[model samples]
Structures are given as structure tokens and as C-alpha cells.
Target: MLSHLEFSGFYFIKNLHFGELGFVQSAQGFIFLSGLLVGLIFMKRHERAGAAQVRRRLWGRALELYGWHIGILLAILALSRLMPDSWFVWNRWLGRLYDGGDVYVAAAAALLYQPSYMDILPQYMAYLLVSPLLIQLIATGRAAWVMAGSAACWLAVQLGAHMPLVALLDGLWMGGATLQPRAAFNPLAWQVIFVSGLVAGALAARGELQPRRLLDPQRPMLFHLAVGGLVFFLAWRMAITTGLIAPEVLERFQAYENRVEFGLVFLLNFVALGYAVAWLLVAGQRSASYGLRVGATLLNRLLSHPFLVLIGGYSLQVFAWHVVAVYLLRLVDWHVGPLAEPLNSLLAVAAIASLALPARWLASRAPTRLADAPQPSRS
Candidate 1:
């Protein structure tokens, strides 16, 4: 968004797809940072008391997430109804299920059901409900064991649980079968990333700083980030250039829609991109250049604002709102042409910035409570 407007007049920039950067990296960064922050908070909490205390505190947080989930679900439904009629259509019945609505009734009946919007909230609830077990595995003192066991559990969750469970509960129309078309965003398949985040958080809490320091800027982080990113791009490009990555798989990248369960390649690239962006952001913050300082200051302020941050914190909400806002605007009058794209991009940036304000405010009230939380044992 920032890129679109700031560089709009530049002939070379006008043709570039800045939205691709927005699509792939941002969510992964959010989730990764969420995990990192969780580690930072939980480990501190555990240090002040014990495992039992930490679990109890986390349980409360899990419940809060569930409450928030329900509220968000309701809000999505309300927004769907309030949207212009042109905004509501029966294109792909399965797509509606992705957005969180009735499965059987909507699919079989081919109806435009109210949007219940089930994505991050349900997965998060599942994660929270099972986090005690996750924490126990992480605290077991061996990184290999934590990684291996977490993988096994997450696999079990997908193969043994969510896919089958969703199938049984929602029927074939909206369950495992949907994986054929939208494999990446399925919560069942995507829990792998979430669990990976949990394990990463757990390891960080244990004072194993290798992963965090992997791109820590004080130590030539940019060089490492560049090397890593270059490697990924080369691999992807080579495969593409050689017709190695299958057409179906390559097509998925072109689909490029944002969803909770992104494909493995997309997932990897997204996280790597996130690391690159974050490292650059951090480096920019410390640079002596005036432009860097200005960029960093604005970034910090946007990230620091409480309401804006709260809205930012609830990424699912921001995404839903952004989509609705864009589509609704289009439906009202379609011929905004090339300018529409940049304008919508700018609007989204503004929305995200506004959302961060609340997040900053809420974070300010947390130091005292956070101070008392116990820390994870660091060996």
C-alpha cells in the first residue's frame, strides 16, 4: 500500500505488484511474532511462579481468545448482511464455507448463508485448548524431541482430527474434500505452522537463542538474510525455469489468495520474507539516514498505537474488513481503473494504521501484570 502510493508516479513502479509482498509475508510475520511474543511473556510468567501458575494464566488467556473469536464471528456475519447486494453472490459455494458459513445447507441448497467467518478463531481455540500439552513437550529439555514430537502431534491433529472431524461434522462438501482445491489454507493442514510457531516460542523461552539470533542484525544479519532469501528465490526460480515444480503447484502461487492455511512452499517463502522484512525494518530503525529515521518513527508509532494495534493484533478482523471494504467499493462503481488498485491499497494501509492505536494502548497497561509472570527454565 505504502509502496503503491509513494511510488505511484514512478513509471517503473507503476507496473510492479506490491500487493504480492502484502499477500505472502505479512500473516506469517504476524504469527511468528505472536509466537515470539508469547514466549517472551510466558517465560517471564513462569519465572515468577511455576509451571502450574503459568498454565493457569495461559488458560485464562485461551478463554479470552475464545471469547474474542465468538465476537468476531458475530461481527463478520453482521458485516456480510450490511454489505451491498452486489457484494453478495453465489459463485463458489465452497468459497462461502471458507469464509465461515453453513456447509450442508449452503452447499447442497446453494444458498447464500450468513458469514460466520471461521478461520483464525477456531484454529486459535484449538491451539489454546491444547497448549498445555504443547508447553509440556517444549519444556522437556530437548530441542530435537520438542520438534519431532510437536510434528508428530500436529500430523495427528490433521490426519486424525480436524480433517476427519470437519468432514464428519460439516460433511464432505466443506471438509477433507476441500483440501483438493484449497489445501494450503485448511486449518487442519495449517496447524503445522501454528505448532511450529509454538515450538519456536518454547525454544526461545528456554534461552536457545540460535533461531532468534539467526538474523539478529548486530551480527551481519542482513548478509545472512540476503543469503537465505537469495537461496529460496534461486531454488524457486530454478524449479520454475526448469519446469521442475509441478504446474498444479506453480498455479497455486498464482492463485495467491490469502488464507490461514498457505501451501508449504508459500509458507516457507512467507516466513523467510517476513524475516527479511523484519530485519530490514530493525536495521532501518537504527540507521543514521534521515529517511530511515522517519520511516522507523512512523512504523514504530503505527505499531505502538493501542486501538490500531488491537485491530492489528486481531489480524483476521483486519483482513476481513479490508476485503469487504475493497469489494464493496468496487461493487458500488467498478470503473475506478488502475487508480482503484492504488487507492484501495492506500485505504488498507490507513485501516491497518488506525487499528494499531488500540494495540499500543492495551500494551501500555501490561507491564505490571507482565512483570509478575514466571519465566520458563533456561538451561
Candidate 2:
């Protein structure tokens, strides 16, 4: 949400771009973690119930996401129509919707015309739609095959195979409009992260993978390497952001850092950072070192705060609301131009605080049976 606010021109803190902090951004984590949780929860569901239940639940989730996508787009369209086009500063993606007429609307409804920040939900929908098949493979002890296929798909995308596929699909349906290939994030390239998480979660669910083993005191080398890689990436990011590095030098590395394709740098950084954090948390609870234990306790407490937990519990609702908040903030920027300090920072914090509204509302109205249902362990 903070990242979205920053992207929407809310400079909550000067020179602090949350989205640009390192090689990997929150979106990668979000996608990977979502896949992880889905894999863990639904695999358990499949075991207890059956494949039918998994299909039903996952398809229902896809439908809910589809509804939210269309509803959000409609809300944005309504707001755009109500505001004067000359006065509003529209993002290029949203602007295409305003100008492209009904064809764009139809395309968006079909999930082929995702617009900027609005794209991720559609990607999630696609993943959820195919999740049953993925889950079946994982459950049947073919997870290695599934992972290999996912990696192959990601590699194919990196080699530019997805481009022609997108072009072909567009040609079949878009006439000459050229919108199908314009998604902000390519699912093909990004699925590797999701599948990696899925396989790990499935293994963890089945007692084949013990996450706590990541903190084994004997693995000091792994811990040290993770810390070293994290520090290097942090320094590299700081250099670029703080102008300590030459632009041309950074430009040469841009290909490996491509956000659209889920580049190599991001994959490596996420792995290192993820392992370090996991080890820290696991060690915080079970480590022999007192100082490390105390530090981990503090970190865990901060992460597990009730307010954060509430937002996490209704993550989908919060995510949807965040997108709405971002678009609405853009509308505000359209009228006021760029906001000055204090005001900008104030609005930014308030926008983040407002994310809890949907979560709270949903919590209040949550069905009793659903609320009481057994949840998968975060451990």
C-alpha cells in the first residue's frame, strides 16, 4: 500500500521510494506468498475433503477476484467520466480506457486489457483458475515435474516466446486495436516464483519440508551468505537511488533488472532476503544465542502486531481497497497538482490507515462458519 501511494505521487517521505528499495519489490513477494498460502491451505483442504472441494473453493476465489476487477474498473471509469478529461492527469493505461471506447471496456472485462496497478489481480485470477491442476500434480507426488514445467515456461518467456503467443491471441480477437500484449506483468515469466512457493508450501504441508531447519545453527555459512548478499544488494540500491553511481553504468545492468520479465537480479535478491528473514524468525524462537533471540523477538512482535494481522487477514479486500485508494489519490493530484510536504506526508499516512476500513468492515460481517474454519499454520 505504501508503494502504491508512492506510485500515485504521494511522497510520504522524500527520497524514500519503497517500491525501488532493492532489486525485488513487494509485488514479487506478494505473488510468491499468495501462491505459498494457497498451496498450503488448499492442499490441506484437498486432503481432508477431496479434489472437488479444492476446485470449488479455488474457482470461487477466481470468480470473486473477477468480480472485484470489473467492479474496480467500472468505478474508475465512472470517476473518469464524471471528471473533466482536461483537468485530470490520467496514467497512460487508464487513459487508454477512457479514449478507446467500448472495445477497451470489453477487452478489460475479458481480462486481456489490464491497466497498470490493476494488472496484478488479473494475474492472480489466472493463477487461481489453473491452481486446481497444479495442486493435483503436487498432491500426486509429481511436484518436481510441475516445478520443472513452470521453470521451462519462465525460461521460454525470458527467451521471448510469450510475445508471439500474446500477439497471436490479439490478432485472433483484437482486430487492429493492439491491446492484448500490453499487460504490465507477464504471467509466464512470473509464474516461476509462484510455482517455487507452491511446491515449497505443498512439501511443508506434507511434512516433507521443515522451515525451522533453515535456522539450524550448523548452517552458519548459509546464514552468513544470505546476510552478505542482502547487504550488497542494499548498498547497490542505495548507490543508484542516492546518485552515487553513474547512470550509464546502471543502464548497462538494466536488462538483468527488468521488472516486467521478473529479471535474474530480482529472483536472486528475493531468495537471499527471504532466506535471511526466515532464518531470523525461526532463530528468534529457537536459537541458542541470547542476543539473536532477543532481536528476533522484537522483529516477530512488530510483524505480528494486531493491526498488521487485521490487514493481512483480509488481504484481498485490503489490496482491492488500496488500488481504489491509489486511483482516488491520483484524482486528487489531478486537481491540486503535486502536494507539498506535511500535506503530502499527512495524506499518505491517512491513505495507508484507511486500508484498515475494508478489513474491519469485512471482519464485522464475516460468516461465523467461515470465520471459525481451521486455518493453515504460518510456521
Candidate 3:
């Protein structure tokens, strides 16, 4: 969540360039953790209510996200018109929505084709849509089958043997206007990561998963290797972003987008960097230094504190509010010239941070305690 907030705040700072310098890996962590939590929650419920109930509830969540996507888009459109410089239509993604008369139809289909700044939720909706099948596979002790299928789908995408569902939507309906036919993050390839996270989370929750590799204090080699991979990626990224090396020079080893396949380099970067983060988070949890221990103590307290737990507990509201916060901050960044630069930066931070305020309020309103306690149950 901090990474997300920072990303939104610095969307103003970065100002339309997504280079190697940006926080690229945070999206994976966000999605992976999301699926992890979903797995933890859904698997427990599945065990109780069975796969059918799990599917229904999962679909309900997807429907909620679908509504959220449309709502956020409409909200942006409504607010954009009120601005004196309502230029998103001409200057940005609003043009995609403005392209046709049957935009009503296109809007209905936003789930398949993604809009800019609003892709992750829809992709998550897609993931959750299939989660029941995933759960069934896991329940049958056939999770390897799902993993194999996910890998095959990813490989099919890599080999150009797959189709973008959005383009198919366009060709079949919507009069063949091919506007933005694929999500920026391809769900085909990324579902593997989601399923992987889900498996890890579910197993851990069930007390069947262990971080035996780097979590083991006896073996420091795996930790060093993970850290080394991260350092290498950072140095390589620096070389490219700083123009010390040409990007194309490493094209065989590393590539970006390339018409939207997550190339080998991208996957390697995610795994390597994710491992580094998990290494620190899990392995370093029990370090010997007094200051480190104190810091961890405070960090755990802050994380469990009502403030963060509130926002974390209600992922949907916080996510929707983030979309609203981001574009509003973008408008302010563009228009508020008197308070440019640093103030813009500060305001962006405040705006993104403000998402927590309402969430905390909502969470606080929940009946965490009885209206009036019964005098300690009187033994």
C-alpha cells in the first residue's frame, strides 16, 4: 500500500515517463499480495461453504469491481467536463471513450479492454472470475495441473499463439474500432504469478507452507543469491536509464513491452526483486540487533494499528479512492501553477494519503466492540 501511495504521489513527479527509474516491480507485489490475501480468505471459506459458494462469492466480488471500474470512469468523465481545461478527451485516454456512438456498449465491455490508469482492477476481476476453478484444482490436490496450464498459457502468449480478448470484442462488436485492445499487464502471463501467490498464501494459512529456502538461518547462500540478483538488476537498469548503455544492446537479454509480452527479463526482474523484498521481510524478522528489533516492533504495531488495518481490511474502497485521488492530483498538478514543483509533490502525497481517512472512519464504525459491554461477563 505504501508503494501504491508513493507511485500515485510521484505520478506527478515522474510526469508521463515510465522509464527504468520508476518503481516497476510494485505492481507485481501489489497484485501478488492481493491474490495471496484472496487465496487465504477464499480457501478458508471454500473449506466451509464448498466450491459452489466460493464461486458465487468470487463472482460477486468481480461484479463489485466491474461496477467500480465503470463508476470510476464515469466519475472521471463527469469531473473532467467541469474543468476549464477538460483536455483529457483530446490529450489522453478520454478520447478512447469519446470515439463512438455505441460507447455505451464499449463502456459495458471495459472489463475485457482496459483503460489507462485503471487496468489492474479489471485484471483482478478477471483473475477472481476464474478463482473457483483454481480453488477446485487446489482442493483436489491437483494444483500442479493449474500451474502447468498457467505456464502453458503464458508460453502460448510468448509464442504469439494467443489472442487479446479485447480485440476479439472489437472485431465481433463495437464496429471494429480497435482502441486499446489489451491490458498493459497481460493477464495471460501474469495469472501464473497470481496463482503462485495464491498457492503460497493458502498453504501458509493452512500451515503447510514454509519458507525453507532463505528462511533457514543455516543457509545464507540463497539469501546472498537473491540480494545479488536484485543488485545486478538495479545496476543494469541504471546503466540503461542513465544512457551509459543502449537499451537495444541488451534486447536479447532484456526487452520492454514488445507488443505486450512479459519478456524473460521482466519475469526475472520480478522474481529477483520480489525475493529480495520477501527475504528481508521474512528472514530479517528475527534479526539480532536491538535497533532492528525495535524497528520491527514498531513496524508491526503500526501495521496492526487500526489506521492501516482499516484501509488494508477494505481493499475495494481504498483502491477505488486511489483512482479518484490520482486523477484529481493530476489535475492539480497540471493547473495549480502558483504552487508548482514541491507543493505539487506534497499535495499529491497528501491526496493519496487522504484515502485512508475515510477508510479508517468506515473501519472504526464497524462493531469491533459491543455497544455496551456486559461487565466482563461476571464470571
Candidate 4:
């Protein structure tokens, strides 16, 4: 449900341009859920197979993501060309992504140098590539080291460090090769969120995680944490709006990070928002009707309707379609101005309900003999 909301929110944020509250970035939850699911699934796979097989399976998943990432970029590049003086505004800067001579290199190395709004997929690929090591660390009972290492990487990047993958690729590309993305989501920084979710999922798979982790309303510490987080976030927003400069660069950067920065405020809101959502979901999961006019059963049914279920199930396909749709919508706004708003809204709904069919069709056409483990959906 959060994933669906986050995907929906992207449309609102991009079109209306204002959903950057402390706890509102849905991608954080989405990615975390992806990690969580992977953790759960990987544990199951490991039990059925072995640690080495789990490693191979994860790398295979990364390779699958790699293919999808490349496919989307290729589509975007083609669309960028197809839209130019004709209609959309995407043509204005799409060519800027690569040098003429470096086009092949850039396309080939898309994982290293993604365009703006395309950072998240590559980050997933990067994390998945190294997930075996992470899972091993946990499987071996070195979770503290996992936390320490993840936090260290995040803090280092937060303190101005960049990933070295781009730097390594610089040797091949002609002209200057700045390895960092156009807009950096800082995967190193985000590992903590994903890994934490991964740990939670793994624990749950092992029957170790408990609902009481968040369900205990009597826990004053948790209440204080939520209150303090919300207060600080709201206060920070007020301060910036009122023209009080932030005390530090990081604090200011979090205000306008291209996507959600997995920092303190994000963690706080994640926990608080997660608690609230989980509580609602648990309450709603019950089939028994409460006193409400629109009971939990109906709400749950709405949540599980074909459209929402399929969208959440085939989220990656929906996401790729979303990128293309957003760009095309921008084009419509450029030329067919009056139709843009209504068209965008229509696209959002159609995107959720219709994308899965094409995705299913494509999957049916795909080679069947290849052995890739089940996809761990973000939702």
C-alpha cells in the first residue's frame, strides 16, 4: 500500500511539485520493502538451496535489473529523439546526458552514469550485486558490523564521498567522465535503510521479528521518538520557510536532495510512518466488521482489488512505464497544453491498471529455460 501511495505520490510531486515533507518520500519505503522482501525470500532460498546458491541467485536478480535499467534508458534516449522540436521538453536536455563519441560508452555503462530520476534502479542493482556479502554478514551473526559498515558508508558519502564505480569507468569514455550521477541518491547512504529492512525481513522469515517492535503503544520511548521526529521535521520546514538558514550543509541538502536522503529525519519518519501504517494494515487485515460505516473488510478489499494488486505485484514494469509516461506527459504539456493535466491524471490511473498486461505479455515472450529466482517486489 505504501508502495502504491509512493508511486501515486510521484505523479503528484512531479506535476504539482510539492510533496517533500520529512516522512513523505514513498521511495524510501518502497526500496526498503524491496530489500525486506529480498531478505525474506533469500533466507527461504538459502534454506532450500545453500549460501552459495543464494549468492548466485541474488546476482542473477541484479543482472535482470541491469537489463531492465538499460532497456528503460534506451527507451528514454529514443523518446528524447522522437520528441524534440515536435512536442515535448525532454528533448531540450536528453542529448546532454552523453557526448557524441561517448554515446556507446554511456549507454553501455548506464549503470554508472544514470540521468536524473533514474538513480533508484541502478542503486537497487548495486545493492543486489553486493547483497550476498551483506546476507553473509547477517547469517554469520555479525549484524553489528553490518550496521557499523552501512552507517560508515552512508556517513562518508553524506560527508561528500562518491562511489568509485564511475571513477573506474572514466578510463574508457572519451572526453571528461564524471562518474557520479546527474542527481545522486547516494546508494551508500541508503544501504542502511535497505539493510535494516533486509534484517527485519530475515528475522521475520526466521520467526524472530515481533509485532511488538512497533505495536506497543505503551512504549514511551517510541512515542517520544515519533513526537521528537515530527517536531524537528516540521520545525526545520518552518525555519527554512521563515528564512532561518540551516546550521549545516547536510541539513540543507536533505531539504532538497534529488530523492529522499536516508539520513536521520528519514529514519525517524520511516519508523513513525511505518508504525502508523502497519497498525492500520493489521487492523484492516481482520475480516470482522467494526463499528465504522465503511468497514475494514471493505477497505482491505479495495486495497486488494486487481488494479492495486497488479500494480504492486508488477511494480518494476509500472515504474519503467511511469518514467516514459512522465516524459510523454511533459511533451503533451509543451505542445498540447490544455490536455496535459487531464491526460496526466488519466495516465496515472491507466498506468496502474494497464501496465501489467504488457509486462505479462513480454514475460510470456521471454526465454523460459533461464533460471532466475522469484522477483522480490518493492511493495
Best by lDDT: 2
Give one digit per residue, the lDDT tens place, for model 4 in 155-263: 7765556646546556445447543344346677777788888887776776777865554434435544655766667666566667786469546656544343465
Residue-by-residue lDDT tens digits, candidate 1, 61-94 = 7777656655644454455457545324322312
Identify the runs in model 2 with alpha carbons over 4 angstroms from their true place.
6-18, 85-87, 91-93, 246-248, 288-291, 366-379
lDDT of 2 by residue, 37-65 (tens): 98899889989998999999999999998
lDDT value, residue 87 of candidate 2: 23
TM-score of 4: 0.74
**Candidates sorted on TM-score, descending:** 2, 3, 4, 1
User: Residue 334: error of model 1 in Å?
Assistant: 6.7
Clash pairs detected, candidate 4: 88-331
- For candidate 1, the per-residue lDDT at 79 reads 51
* Distance from true location, Cα of 216 in model 2, Å: 1.6
What are the root-mean-square deviations of the candidates from the true structure over C-alphas? 8.9, 4.8, 4.7, 7.1
TM of each candidate vs. truth = 0.59, 0.90, 0.82, 0.74
Alpha-carbon shift of residue 10 in model 1 (angstroms): 17
Task: Report the poorest 10 consecutive residues by lDDT, candidate 4.
Answer: 1-10
Error of 3 at 266 (Å): 2.7
User: For model 4, what is the C-alpha lDDT against the true structure?
Assistant: 0.63
